[model samples]
Target: MSSEFPTPGLKRKARKGGPDVPMWAARADLVKRGYEPKTVRLPYRLDEPDDAPLLSAACLRLQAEMLEWSSGHLRDPNRFDGTIRSLSRRYQTDPESPFNRRLKHTTREKDAHVLTLIEKAFGDRLVPSLKLADFWRWYDAAKKPKATGQPERVRRAWGIMKKLRELFAYGVAAELDGCARVRDILAEIRFPQPARRRVTLDLEHIEAFIPKAIEMGRISLALATAIQFDAVMRQKDVVGEWEPIPEGEALTGIVLNGRRWVNGLTWAGVVLDGVTRKATTKTGAMIAHDFSLCPHVQQVAAHVLPERRVGPLIVDEQQGRPYAGDAFQREWRKVARAAGIPDHIWNMDARAGAITEAEDAGADLDAIRATAAHTDAKTTARYSRGAVGKSRTVAELRLAHRAVKNSA
Candidate 1:
């Protein structure tokens, strides 16, 4: 074949083709040099003709290129095969697959953390051989013995396992197109049983701790005690802040009046600023309620100097900072010891005590739920058991009375 083409300076040159190349080969050569392929532009239409042949050819070319690359770069044949299998299973067609969407949902940090754990549990060499069984074995090893009273550790392990399982499922779905076998494998796994609900503190036990708090010269301890008794605020919330109620006046001398404290607002509520970053109640809710502050609480709040009013209501005088969760726990232990209460009467005990007291006081279920800010009624029901037991006693007495009358 011979071709005549104009050069940049408008000079024509006859170029001879080597060994009479085919038309298609020549066309490809032209395309390699940046010449556009000739095709008729179709008019806008709702239905388009199938381009399966062209698509198949393109895919074949891409597969060939990938194979060449993998042959050189991927030294491990097993890993390469696994990767190819995963890709095919996840997407019927890689170009339009949902793998990218799934990948986008996961963070690099989370993946790295999970991978580290997996690698540590199973040596690096065995990590590549990780199956669902390997994950379960790792989880079992991580769990503490049932007799250890380390239910929290077991729960943590379960959480980690669940997260890992989700990641695995996502990978299988996206990389293997969808792995029903993996899903079936995960379905058989069961989490460890959670700890039973143990109400560790009673009203009497908490009341005993107040004197010790007062004796320790911990001003905020008195407030915390009062809040725990009155509002069902968790330990974290009770100690977080002591905001002044709008148009509120501070409680004055305690001895002068039988009432321990009086606030401008009907209820001495904590002002919860949603924007602030801090630990919240387990339910992630805040409460503002009217409850009578204890006489000791009134006394302590009044005594604080004007300069120390900022930050959390509870403060460490030495640190000149608000007492954190750990600090509060430590103080609580000390207070419990001084009050002649068992060490089990920790901060959470106060919350449980409040719930028990409220139910005993004949507060309806709705009222208790509102105070606790529980998302589910089931949680509120847990606290209402004490109240239910008391009610059942009354009902049993009435039933016995009727039975005696009938026998007579």
Candidate 2:
């Protein structure tokens, strides 16, 4: 409602019913008034009112400084400098100000990557005026025909496009009635194909594999597999020295050491206690529990030779070095093949098998949920649903028989 700034002589007139202008428009307005765009302090208010009040001169100065700081660190520093210089001159003010020091620290690399991919895919047509359907068509064409190989690359590209849409929406939300257009584009963007489910290994296959690994003189591999089978740990979890708990003897749940071993899990390595840090569980905050080593797991742990004060529970024999994730996968695959299991058995299957085995052993839903660190019984049910069905059917059959007998 307040029109304090007048249209510059060089600036183009606003359309009779056209949408309100953007920050870029304000720069143009300044330029028309014989002021350089770079010199203008574009008004912007911080979300935190404690920092500065909205519409205040201090807020406007702080906003300009924040923009300058962001632009200075751009990969093409000159491009950002030029943009800022144009704005500063239009506003008849310097871009650099003391307020710039208070700007929040952020990395724009991911956003930059997204922008680059969008530009490459859609060229000049990547602007907000383009329809959402057009962007989807462009995205589909950019990805290869085949589903094989890394899907993450394709996913990342889609993510970039989504970010661009958000940027456009954020820019226009207050003034333009077209905010709905950007929202529609985001809602319509299709995600990449979901990852294929990994093959789960059954107990029979695991029983066959353990002996062969030991026979082949792969002591570490044998132990790792045994732990995977019995404890139902992910490949990452099984490879390292267990996280030390005050009550180690109680042996509750597996607590992974935060630090990765140098040679990885393949070679004997040390757990860097200095690097030990707490990580939030997917289900939110929960106490880290110590995993109890089963007899077979204990046997594997027993074979670990002490080199330093504290080290990895498993290591590579030949290199005496740690094994990386990829290397471990390759070697583990060989062991799986020799043991006569199908090639599809993957790391995740151990987790699935553990859930299945626990259900088969008559563990209740709550017990399974707690053991697996699942956020709720519903998720645990997904893993043990088959066992649950079987148990329910048996219970119903017994109840029916009891009812008939009582009537007799």
lDDT of candidate 2?
A: 0.50
What is candidate 1's lDDT per residue for 1-408, written digit by digit as tens?
A: 112211111111223962221111113343364432111111111121243343333334334434444355532222212222322223322433443344422243444465455435432221123457766776777676756654446765675676556544655644442244555566688877556556646667755666567677766676676666656666656555222232354554221122331211111233322221223434456555543334434545566666655644665555555553367678767777777887654667666777777777767768788777777768877755355545866898999999999999
lDDT tens string, model 2, 1-408? 123432222122334685322232234443464432322222232233432332344324434544444455322221222222221121222123211222211123344455555544443231234566666766666555456664435655466555555544443432333445665666766667435443456678767777787777777787777766665454555464322344435544333343224211322222222121122223233323233435555555555555532445566666564564367778878888888878767645776777777887777768777766677788766665345545766898999999999999
Against the correct fold, how does model 1 do in TM-score?
Answer: 0.54
RMSD of each: 18.2, 12.9
Give residue 405's lDDT in candidate 1 (0 to 100): 100
Assess candidate 2 and give its TM-score to the true structure: 0.51
Ten residues in sequence with the least summed lDDT for candidate 2: 97-106
Candidate 2 Cα errors over 4 Å, as ranges = 1-130, 135-184, 188-198, 240-293, 302-310, 385-408
The lDDT for every candidate, in the order shown, is 0.49, 0.50
Model 2 / residue 361 / CA error / Å: 2.7
